[model samples]
Target: MHERIDEQITFRRLEVLLAFMEGGSLAKAAEMLDTSTVSVHRALHALEEGVRCKLFLHQGRQLIPTDAARTLAATAREVLSTLSSGIRTTREVAGYASSVLRLGSLYSLTLETVPAMIGELKAREMGLEVDLTLGSNTELLDRLSNGTLDAALLAVSELGAEFQTIELFEDEIFFAAPTGSKYAQHKTIDLQACSHEPFVSLHEGFATYHGFQRAFHLAGTTPTVAMTVGDVFSLTSLVSGGVGYTLLPGRIRGFLKDRVHFIPLDSRFQMKQQIGLTFLSIRERDPALLKLGVICRAMAKRFGIRT
Candidate 1:
């Protein structure tokens, strides 16, 4: 009879083996798992040592499972599957949003994107528990890496290697003003032409603020930021009050459409903010996390937030 492995070989190590077998190479496995090939190899070595046998043999640049490896692989598949099912089901029994889904986003989405999404989730995930935190991408990333968030929606310049991402939607920063403003009835206004208008904008340290600045620089214009605020709703409110005209996502109208007016920035180059969901690839085992991602994708599409 085969001896049981010491320290139980860890569910993570078993997952590496399963991923390797399916991918047929350590590099591919690492790609799928969002880790380095070196890490995957070391995990497999430790797993094989734990089992006290060779689980795989290299064959002409390919990894092939041995007979024991085959048997153990099949067993591993079932063990992981059963364990996963138990954990997933247990989480459901506990509650949906049983824990907080730590979320972060650009300041622009706080008005409609965040509130609407959370409201919809509560309506559907009845009796589910959720702990919500609102912050910019940087603040949220710090929390997410520290395990404070299971998943978050954030603005990204580019994706990194530590997490998996699902595209939510692109928010084209529309030029906004009160109905009595000069551009109120214009079909579309040129972004560059607004260079002279006093504008309300997000404060620095927020991603959207930096993004908008970059876009303005690219357009070879320096905007006169009449006011620098923290939240998107505030920006819209200020605009409606005729404090100053500004650029915001079209979706923000979900809350204050009656008070604000939206006109597409018909610039030769319009700035767009990408909003999407992000989470550690390791947490994919949590069925609740996966389910929320699925729901969010559907939500984004339904609300026309998906590109």
Candidate 2:
């Protein structure tokens, strides 16, 4: 009987059982279901035989449900309710039930760029909802590749063949040190000047870390990295507290304005972070993404960033 149930029990059969339990008779269940009485009776019989138990008793033309049938019917109602709710939530997560734009960016951008972008997007499109994700550059790229993010704002030193990108701006890397430090007093300092200074830097996967490597390589010196951290904020705090000096983009200067000072790098060691908006090339025609691209370009131009 268990084997028969495993092979034959289906959602439709459960629904038929439920209708029969509620209506209490084959003819009444068929009337409520708008089906033939024969179909209802057959369904009930199949269900009982499959379970190897008498689910109903027949007296004259009336069908009364047994205790086991009542118990199964209650469980079936809960299962169907839960299944319906799961389907609804799945649709929402898949973006079928909402006007959500999944936007991704680096954690460093949240200090200014991300907030400004979100404000502009909301202003331009009424009723548009944004789902923002802030992560390391590597994490954002991975999410973008896997379709988890609809678009991303990130530093793009090297463009991937499968991505469609709009150049937003180029930010020059600067030497960030504690206020009143020797490097801070110089208008432009050569990277080699601080080659012996203790440095705090982001981890390897970060775009800024790559720029740091490029700076040292061009200067013909290696930095004495005293500590490594995960995010830009922590790196800034470490620099402000006099932990060590580090190289970072000028865009973040506003964040630790009072606690830290940024000086330009010499031409020989100059490195620029090419920041842009990126999305899969296959999503080029997405209307929301197109609108966002236009907004980002406008913001970049307003800030005197080369478009």
CA deviation > 4 Å runs, candidate 2: 1-98, 304-307
TM-score of each: 0.63, 0.67
Report the Cα lDDT for residue 259, model 1: 73
lDDT of each: 0.76, 0.84
Q: lDDT tens digits, residues 38-101, model 1? A: 9998898888888889887878866688888778778889999999899878665543345555
Local lDDT at 61 for model 2 = 82
Task: Report the C-alpha lDDT of model 2 over 1-307, residue by residue, as the tens digit.
Answer: 3433454566777889888877777777899889999999888788787777888888888888889999889988998888889977875675433578888988877877888888997887645588998877788889988889888889985666888888777888999999988777898988876798899999988899999998899888989999999989999999999999999898888887999999888888887888888888877866677777788889989877766
**Per-candidate clashes, comma-separated:** 0, 0
Total clashes for model 2: 0
